[model samples]
Target: MSAPLLAIEDLSVTVRTDEGHAQIIDRADLVLRPGSIHGVVGESGCGKSTLIKAVLGLLPRRSTIDRGRILFEGQNLLTLPRESMTREVRGRAIGFIPQDPFQALNPVFRVGDQMMELLRWHGLPGESPPSRGRIDRTTRARHRAHLISMLGAVQLADAEEALERYPHQFSGGQRQRLLIAAALACGPKVILADEPTTALDVTTQLQILKLLRDLAETFGLSMVFVTHDFGVVAQLCDTVTVMYAGQTVESGPVASVLGTALHPYARMLLACHPDRAADLAGIPGAVPSPLAPPSGCRFHPRCPEARDACAAARPATREPAAHHSVACVLHDEPATATATR
Candidate 1:
């Protein structure tokens, strides 16, 4: 319907070191609409985090984009001017909820000050300038009012008191809520949350998910939630992208991906979940290092249905149904294999 809010085509990323560059994200293709929540899931080091980070232009200093494009609202983000990108976009156009608020928030600044600083950088200058140092009293009050309302939007109580307190003063969930408030204050359309609930307790994690759902509905916010937990994706995402090694092995509507998983890697991932029935069991062996992924499917080393051909030819992504895609040859099970096994 609406133009895709974000489109990532054949994205490939690598970490550069003194020795050489090692690619961690390879050939990730994704498309998201204005209000859809797309979840990218995989075990640790599966390059789930790196894919989104590359899109946000928030890659680590050692990282580099070897190939592909990140298109946001139809503009190529990879080639946008860094300073302008950060100012007009990054936090402002697309909000980010990091996995750890402890590391994202500043210990030195008061909660409200941090919000104000972010607001000031790209804020309508005449409307809201530096409020701390001798500005028009009217402008200062307006900014403060906007800030308080934002805190209230996140359902935080005692807005004034919370503002005066530093990040450490708030609980884990509270700090995350504060980050969410800051994110909303920027008037962003999409929120790129990297395992936003990983650091919180189960109860708090659920609450945060509810908050995100509510925020998405109320603000029409599209979201890219990066997580290893399929359960979270089941609850929050409209679609799921299952990654293994450094590439997406499956992508589809959440229900289709979960209920009718086809890729051996996708099936293995679901098996790893304890809640899955015994018939649907855990995958054997640790994920191979990206420095040297297994040949062919990259999952052949552990796939139950892996065939000699699987080890010889990597299956490219193919959609058997309109919304279901898998990158494993089993989908095309040759007449011989279907008859034999």
Candidate 2:
């Protein structure tokens, strides 16, 4: 297997709220390989979004990376200088597709203007020193053509005329496609999408999903898609990591994780999927507050198979099958030993 393009090791993030410091992410780990799509799935408030933001250095003002490393390529993003991150990393090497396209775009600016500004800042993908100023008509024309081609790549109709319109002029799906265009405009190595399809209708959602998968393949771009839907993961991801109350509970190839989920929380999450459930169901109890999470396994309170040791200390991650790792005490014993017993 190829070395990871992006690896998040023991990342923990905290935020200062009215109550106190809340540890939103706790010792989370995830790995994304080159040219593959990895999904991060969990219930709302499980710190999925926080994990993504930490990678891009987009965390809120009060948030801090308490410890851990976000390794991209070979450097630790957490230690990168702010100027370098802004000029060399964000939008240049790593693109971002925000959740709400409506909110992501400026209501007051033309769609073309917004995208042009990005090109101006980052300079088109490969141009040395970046085309900061439009030296002549030719340079301006080049940027315009590139933007139009990008819009076209995302399948936005009337790409030329669409550039003249504002964000409000496009449909929900179209706005999403526009965001995708902007993310790909800089020719990034990796794209980070934070539930980009959550706001669209079912049909539109499916279309966006297909578009994302197609775009990734066409560009050979690696992606980290954050979503709560198992259906989306099964459809779009090559690999997946299950997060709960901040910690990663299970991770592996999507087929292995979905077919034989070792962690109890993972199984329960899969059970709640509409196709898998006989009736609509939800995991019992609510996610614990980050201010004072359960002592050991964050999911212990709701995990059916949880035992005394589960609350005593966090379970050490282990793999019973190749490429599959789970952080639950249930998998502490080797499969062969358990079977023999």
Candidate 3:
């Protein structure tokens, strides 16, 4: 029927440093269907956020994407001009919620202004700027109404009062909710949320997750959420992509991957989480350096299952069943959309 909402094939991003260039995203491949929450989980420095930034063309000037095809709604994103890219996807076809809510919003502008800008950029009627110098009363009123309606959608009460307050006035959770409201205000088809709950407390984290799920369902938004925590992924996502040293190591339905992880890195990652640990003290040692990553699997040094084969060559992704896939050598069968079954 409908084609996939987003498809990333053989994606790689490189950043130039004083020494030389280093590839951060190593041929990462993934797909996101309409209204589905596909998660990218990994340790710190795993290039999870960088992947989203790449799609948005928001990578640092030093960073360059060397290879990949990012097709969004059947259009090739990388080839599209930057101005058009900003107009279409930044907030129209997609939205981005950075990990830090406090930083994402502008301290100078009122919350309403940010929302107005998003609408204006998408060319929403009545909010269009005639020029740098001029707009009338009608546009202002329409902007206010739009802002208030969006405020209500995020479960933020006192919409009118909140509009007057600057970004710093709101609590951490409220600020996050505000960002989400803005991200969804444009009716984006895809929302790239990078650790949306990391800055909030445990209770607030749960509440925000529930709100996100509710909004995603109501709006039919396909989400690409990034987080290092498995607990969050388990609760909010349907499918997952596990990354280590910037490469995907395993991907499958959340339940299957979590319960029966085939990749050595994936297993160790889950064991390290406090919520999943029974007697295991969690994996010792940190993720390898992105600048000088370990050879072959890149995770071979940390993987208990690491073998001569793993150290010799990069393991190929295996599709053992429909909808299930793993990059570890442990799985010999190739996983496909229909294979996980």
Candidate 4:
């Protein structure tokens, strides 16, 4: 396939909690192909957001990437200096759409002003200057035109008028669309959307999902979409990575991974989906704390298929199908040779 627009390999992140170092992410792996939507699905506290932040080099000061590489266009993001990440990567090469629209947009600023500031700082070469200069009419007009075009592209009604309004004036869905617009403003290669539709109503959620899918296709943008919903992944993602606790349990083409999930945790997660479960069952037991997770597989305590071997050591990744990998022992050896088949 196309060289990965972004590839996260064996990424591990930790945070300094009162209890000492808490492992927030454990060797998480993900790959985003050009012009495709890759979904990162997991329950809360599973390190979904932490993975995204690690990719963007936005990990908090207390957070540390203990190992692994975040390769974007062949460059390891973890090694890039803060200045390079700010000027060359984040916002310019990779854009972000946060979970909350109400909180993402500044309440005090007009939409136009906020967008103009983005353009002023991160806009394409020649459109933005290194140092602040006179806010000339030509610059203002160019920025306004681009904003209007992006707003229109996102289907925001009366784009011109909408730009003059404050964040409060727009409905939840409209605000989300505006965030999408801003994320696309700089024409980045990839967009990291951290459950952008989680706060919207059902109908609005569907609308946002469709918009995101369409935008990815239309702009040739690869997106890493983070969400807890399998239905959303089935609808909008070309590939999916399932994370449990702080580890990635399964990853592959959405059709392959979702249709015949090999990992016990992945299977249990699928069973918990509203459409798949007969009575809307929930996964047994709770997610283990990162500070003191289970000895081996993070999900071993909750996995119905767990065995003595599973709790002995973390499972190694095995591939039963092309482009599909699962970190579970059932897919291994003569003892369980047919388990995944």
Candidate 5:
């Protein structure tokens, strides 16, 4: 296939706390191709969000890139200067749809004002300069028209009036759509959505999912969708990456990885999905603390198939089937041999 539009290679991020340095993302790798949605699924605190934050250069002030490179369109984002990253990378090339829409938008400001600020910053289509820091009447009209068009693209109703209200005035789903509209306003090549539908009702969640899928296809936008729901992954993603304890345990085409997951952790996660007739069962243990992750394989303590070798050393990523790779000792044997479930 073509070169990845975005890639994370051996990325590790660390944060400083009162105790000491804590490694949040450990040697994680991912690739997002053009015109496709890649799902990053894992339990909370597994570094799924941290991985995306690193990609967007939105890591916390206390955090440091301990190692690895994040490449977007052939350039290493980690090496890019802060000014360049802010001016070119953050919103223009990569858009972010935050999990909490209320928090994402300013409560005091009108929705349109926030969107207009972004449009001006990114110099998106229909943007007009303000004279002496004051927007002319004609420029304001053009911006409102552009904003309305973007709101309509996200299927938001009453686009003109919606822009005049505060974020709290809209329902959760509408707020989400507004956030999506703002993300699209910049015409980004990639949209990183962090649990964008988690807080919505079931019907609204489905609507938002459909909207995102439609937007990706219509705009040829690549998306890195961070979610815990396998149903969403199956519905929206072309490929899936399973993360645990800050590491990628399994990754492949969604069908192969979900249908025949090689890693025990992956199997456990899929087993918890309620889509199957089988009774739902959650993974046995809580995610290990990043400040003191388990030695060797982080999931060894909870992985049913983990052997003595697992605790001895971290398993290398192994490909047991075409387009499928798992980082577990079970897959270390010859491909002809079957891994014990």
Candidate 6:
């Protein structure tokens, strides 16, 4: 197989709290292949967004990457200089579609101007430098045309007209489409979408999902789609990584992991889905506090099949099938009978 487009290896992130430093992402590993959408599913506060922020070098001031590397196309992102990352890595190589469309765009400027400014700053092909003196009308027209074409690809109606308006002038879905257009403006190899459809209605959510999938395929883009919804993962992702508190518990091809989840937490997550459960139920117990996560197996406290050995030490990831792995002790011994009571 070809090398992964993006590889997050044994990454750990820590943040400063009132009490002390707390690790939010612990030894998390993810490998995203080119031309595929990988789903990162976990409850809120499970370090989903933290993982993405680490990849983009957008971590908060109080946060620090305590260990491991984030490699994009074999280049270590964590080691790159801040200026180099801002000028070369972000937008040009990797795009981001943040959860809140309203917060993503600046309300003070027209949408068209914002996009053109980004294009010029990134030095996208055909963008002339203002320092070289007055830009010809032809260059300005070409820039506008390029913006309209990108918006049109996102299926925005009256793309040219939409450009002249402010972000607030459009509906929630339209604003999302515009953000997506901006993300694609630089033709990135990877797109990190953090709950991009969480704020929209079900119908709009589906529409956005389809649009993202289409865009990924059209652009040969690799994507890390972070969300709490398994249904969305089932619908759009080719592979899935299920995280808890701060650890990756299960990961594999979507069909293998979803159809036959090996980890107790994975099973519980699938069982709680409305379509799978007779009654709509949620997983019992809240996520463990990141500041004081449970020792050994993070999910042992809530796992129905937890045994005494579970709390003794962290379980090593075991593979029972090709490309499928689960971080649970049940797979450690053949005599250990499975129970989900």
lDDT of 2: 0.92
**Model 2 — which ten-residue stretch has the worst lDDT?**
332-341
Candidate 5 per-residue lDDT over residues 114-145, each given as its tens digit? 89887666665434334334565776677678
Local error of candidate 3 at 249, Å?
Answer: 0.6
Model 5: residue 167 alpha-carbon error in angstroms: 1.1
The residue pairs that clash in candidate 3, if any, are 319-333, 319-334, 319-335, 320-335, 321-339, 321-340, 322-338, 322-339, 322-340, 323-340
Candidate 6: stretches off by over 4 Å: 125-138, 334-341
Q: Estimate each model's TM-score.
A: 0.91, 0.96, 0.92, 0.96, 0.94, 0.94
TM-score: model 2 vs. ground truth: 0.96
Tens-digit lDDT track for model 6 on 1-341?
56899999999999999998898999999989988899999889899999999999999999989899999999999999997798788977899999998788899999998988767666444343344334457766876888999999999999989989998898899999999999888778899999999989999999999999999888788999999999999999999999999899999999999999999888888887898899887788999888888888888888778887777788888889889998888888754434333
Model 5, stretches more than 4 Å misplaced?
125-139, 334-341
Off by over 4 Å in 3: 125-135, 333-341
Model 3 clashing-pair count: 10
By the TM-score metric, which is better: model 1 or model 3? 3
lDDT of 3 by residue, 1-341 (tens): 24679988899999999877788999999889887899999988998988999888899999988888999988989999997787767777788888999899999988877777776656443233345424468866766787788788889999998988899889999999999988877677899999999999999999999999999988778999999999999999999999988898888889998988878788888987888888656666778777787777888787776666666678788787667788776664333112221
The digit string of per-residue lDDT tens for model 4 on 122-216 reads 76533444354346677679879999999999999999999999999999999999999998987788999999999999999999998888888
TM-score between candidate 1 and the true structure: 0.91
Cα deviation at 114, candidate 1, in Å, is: 0.7
Model 2, 1-341: lDDT tens digits are: 99999999999999999999999999999999999999999999999999989999989999988889999998999999998898889998999999998899999999998998777777777874354444456766778899999999999999999999999999999999999999999889999999999999999999999999999999999999999999999999999999999999999999999999999989999999989889887789999999999988899898776677788788899988999999988878654123221
Cα lDDT computed for each candidate against the true fold: 0.82, 0.92, 0.83, 0.88, 0.87, 0.88
What is the lDDT, from 0 to 100, of the residue 157 in candidate 2? 92
